[model samples]
Target: MVQQWDIVKIIGAIALPQMGGWVNGYLTRQEIKGWYQNLNFPSFRPPNWIFAPVWTSLYAGMGYASYLVWRDGGGFSGIAQGPLFLYGTQLALNWAWTPIFFKRHELKWSFVELAALTATVAATGFAFFNINKLAGYVFIPYFAWCSFATLLNYKIYKLNPESTATIEEVKEPKKKTN
Candidate 1:
């Protein structure tokens, strides 16, 4: 049987990842301030401001799903841990992606990473469904967002393969006037 403290621990573990992701996301926003403003984003791109609220809600859902799994006790037996582990792994990857894409400006690598993250999240969702239906449902928005992000990353990479440079590098150029 799972105690309340166990539930708290699971929620805490899940929240830690989400909080880290949120902070990294904020930093990425700061790093890409002007870059996003200048990009040739797709027509399907949501307004820039929409991301904050969307992510916040998604993270909340993730946290709740974790709590559910944690409270389920033996409910997490067998392959149940699969979803939880994948959930955490994908969250970590997701958090790292913003720094790679925005801070390092590695659009190509970012595209690949985002694709992997999307696949992991999809797998997590499927695994979670076997453990808890609602838990799986909670990840839908997260999976959807990653899918959209993968498309965006690919477009950005295609649009500017040679544009992979740190913000500082992009701002500086060698003089060559003859």
Candidate 2:
């Protein structure tokens, strides 16, 4: 039997991760269509159309997993603190990846970030599992996807070495003071 507050928590939990992704997507939209389109992706890279649906599903799953962890581990109480912290950390890393990769075009740095994100995600999953088995289990697909994405990022970094070069900033002419 689910209570009213439970429903609210469930909705809130699920929406949180999705919201992070939305913000990142919104910020990186221009780069996705422009800079990202020019990248040399691996043969295994899926079509652009696949990313939205796949990521949406993955975010939803991760949200639900967090909800389970929250519910089963005793909300924000001491017991849930560690797992939730890991969740928040991974979520932040997840949000940071797109802008780093797409907008800034920092291929190598983005790959490094993604690798860290993957490890943090794996740790979070394990922590969630300790709280609730289902919560841990729900992270499987996310972990798998992250692993795949890490490989893809690595390949992109390798294939596009020129992308990693530091851009020389052209200084504006010194303004003449009145």
On lDDT, the leading prediction is: 2
Each model's TM-score?
0.80, 0.91
Clashing pairs in 2: none
Per-residue CA lDDT of model 1 for 32-58, tens digit only, reads 567666666666767767877777778
Query: On residues 29-146, what C-alpha lDDT tens digit does candidate 2 reach at each position?
Result: 7677777788888999998779888899989889989998888888888688999999999999999999788767788999999999999999999999999998899888999999
Write down the RMSD of all candidates, one decimal each: 3.7, 4.7
Best by TM-score: 2
The lDDT of model 1 is: 0.77
lDDT of each: 0.77, 0.89
The parts of candidate 2 lying over 4 Å away from their true place are: 166-178
* TM match of model 2 to true structure: 0.91
Model 1 RMSD in Å is: 3.7
